[model samples]
Target: MGQQGRSRTNGQGGPGAVDGFFEYARERQLIKLRRDAGESPPFTGDPVLRAYRFCNVFREDDRTTAWFRQNVRDVLRESPTEVTLATITFRWFNRIEVGEQILDILLEDGWNAKRIRSRLRNVQPLVTGAYMVKTPPGMSKLEGIIWCMKHINRRSLPQMPMTSLELAHQWLTQYPYLGDFMAYEVITDLRHTFQLQDATDIMTWANPGPGAARGCEWITGHKYNRHSKTDRVAMMNVMRELLRLANSDEAFLWPEDWPRWEMREVEHTLCEYDKYMRAVNGQSLKRRFDASHQGEERT
Candidate 1:
């Protein structure tokens, strides 16, 4: 934990020490949210998978059936790592549909770097979504795909090493467009799709993305200060305590389908909280997966 977290905990003391920042939330009775019953499938028994499930932010009013996301549920049975790397490479600064389309191109072209470049050379550029993606000048979307392919090829591995999820994050973020959030996302993907790491593994770590950070603040009334090591440690601590409370004898249980949460899942819960609030409250930035389309909003 950082100095900020330690100070806060020390001031509050005991169980409330970690949770005291959110006294306002408790006063407002914001902890318990009304979620739809059995909207999606129950989380698989796999601990890691359950954790990943908790990461996704689903809302009761969301248009669950509006879009068809074939790619999300599609698991690569063969050449998993190659496909995983290809998917992550194409995913950066792009929408889910766009990324899936790019992935199809790579797969059809046999993951051939030059062939893909040649085919996509004259391809029309696409504009979708609101955010600006920073890429090198003259780098077409196809070229971006190739850049990732080459990047992964140099490493000679499909997914990152499972030994240290944190280390894998460091390795992936060294790339041009891949940042901390994207890297953590890729790590989550590897765990969810290819079973690269266990959800309950002590070394496994999933940092909340921007959405999760905002959600944490809204729900807890505490700013999830991204730049502060103390804040980061505090965030993890609160998540741990909250999950324990949710399943404890005191009976703060969640929905049956909600499943027991792990650390990664707790990280996900915060992100989803951010998304739910944005949509319900009509924030300027609406959710990318706007219930009109089914997709993974987070990378």
Candidate 2:
């Protein structure tokens, strides 16, 4: 047997091995179901592959970010109005096509909600239908843009500092409709524009979204408590330990082509796993993973 077959029943496993094993099995089951139904598999043939061509679908690569920064430099370099517009476009729709269309309309209609609403009325149904399940009280997407404008224009509110993710996200959350997830998105975008010192370090402080919470619960066999900071820390500890073992043990080795995962990347992977589980099994744990989190943005 190769390392994988030998390690499967060795009575020893790395921290992430259990999760990986389950995921591998689940993927195999999915493939079998698809074949039985006369449908194609969602990804490649290998159930155990950690990284694939589709890995970049959810996560941003360095090249993608760099290209994004260059293209938006003009908008980011100008007045805070432009920054507000760009951030709102991203937060509200998040989809590039929808966001770009609304942004173009905003430029033509001016920053206020009333004008944008009037101009976008034709496509309002489609746009509004695409919004997540819950929204800020009495706040539409157009209103969200205006709210961001007001916050950005406020002289009393300090500019988002590069090093302080907490302070930046806190300020963003004070605005209506800008929850933790949206705040993190805005701060991440602004960080690209700021070009400030320690910008790369801010991701380490990022709050995991609802999907990530669910993923963590599933991966840890429903043992991780999302509400407890101690449990969150424990999850990170487990990931780190698993990574260490994967590096040393051939049986636990991840995809050779894949780069080392940062903690934030691991969190991202958990979120993707959550989506995958929902599609494949729809078998959610009895405990509520989302109860402890605030400012959730679910799709």
Candidate 3:
């Protein structure tokens, strides 16, 4: 793990408010689903949702993730390790086009940090705002990243034993540049692609980041700890409970055409729900959505 990984989870909501949280997730998902079907602007009449940007209900539906599948994952499907390496490389930058450039360097016949630096030298702000990568003092972020990539490619990560999601997360986080948060993110992508079979068998394994922890807390009306292994397991239980409620609820009918929700997707949406609730409560948000951003999909 590098620099940004562990953090204290803090928030509380009424146990009775689970219904409200469910409603928000349901409506937010509906808006995205409708917009995807070629609907006009103002996807929702709810002012907060309309004005603010939130991630899609399913992580796979995110635009960059779609690009990842086509441009990176499929390109290297023969080797699971290569797919994982490209996935990490793509996600490290989080920009579809720019990620491809970096990935080319990664897949080159020779490993060269200088080449990586040259391609990204003039590129101001190489990373997307979705995730931040921090390096040690005096060492440039580019150099740190190159070193990290070299280690990942050369290490035995592909050969590592992954008996469960928690163990996969643990082994992956042991590498540089992969924090608690990013390890789970990469592993989720890997599992969704069916790379980590043994790990995905455990249905209740969803690692919580700070945002997901807040979301789980919001739904359960209790404090959730992202650090504790026990709490990580419990967090998914809350997700399952909410999912069960959604299946039985009359107000929110999940579209049959849509893919079934997975623990990973639910965990991701929970973070977006946390952001949505934050906006509803009048808290400041980092991203804004307006008419200019319409028709453009983002991850």
Q: Please report the candidate that would top lDDT against the real structure.
A: 3
Better of 1 and 3 by lDDT: 3
Worst 10 residues of 1 by lDDT: 60-69
> Model 1, stretches more than 4 Å misplaced?
1-80, 93-110, 118-132, 193-195, 199-204, 246-250, 275-284, 287-291, 294-299
Candidate 1 lDDT tens digits, 258-288: 4455556556666554543343344444433
Query: Model 2 off-target regions past 4 Å?
Result: 1-43, 46-58, 61-85, 102-115, 125-158, 195-197, 236-260, 278-299
* lDDT tens per residue, model 2, 1-299: 12453244233234653545334434433433354476643433442222221123223342323333444434564444455455554455544344445555534322455654565555543332223523546776555455555554434334555456656677667766567776765666665454322455543455666666666665555566656899767766655553454334464444444445444555555665554444334344332322121111222
Off by over 4 Å in 3: 1-16, 106-112, 153-155, 246-253, 291-299
- What are the per-model C-alpha RMSD values against the true structure? 9.5, 8.7, 6.6
TM-score per candidate, chains pooled: 0.61, 0.60, 0.84
Error at 122, model 1, angstroms? 6.0
lDDT of each: 0.47, 0.47, 0.67
Rank by TM-score (best first): 3, 1, 2
Better of 1 and 2 by TM-score: 1
| lDDT value, candidate 2, whole model | 0.47
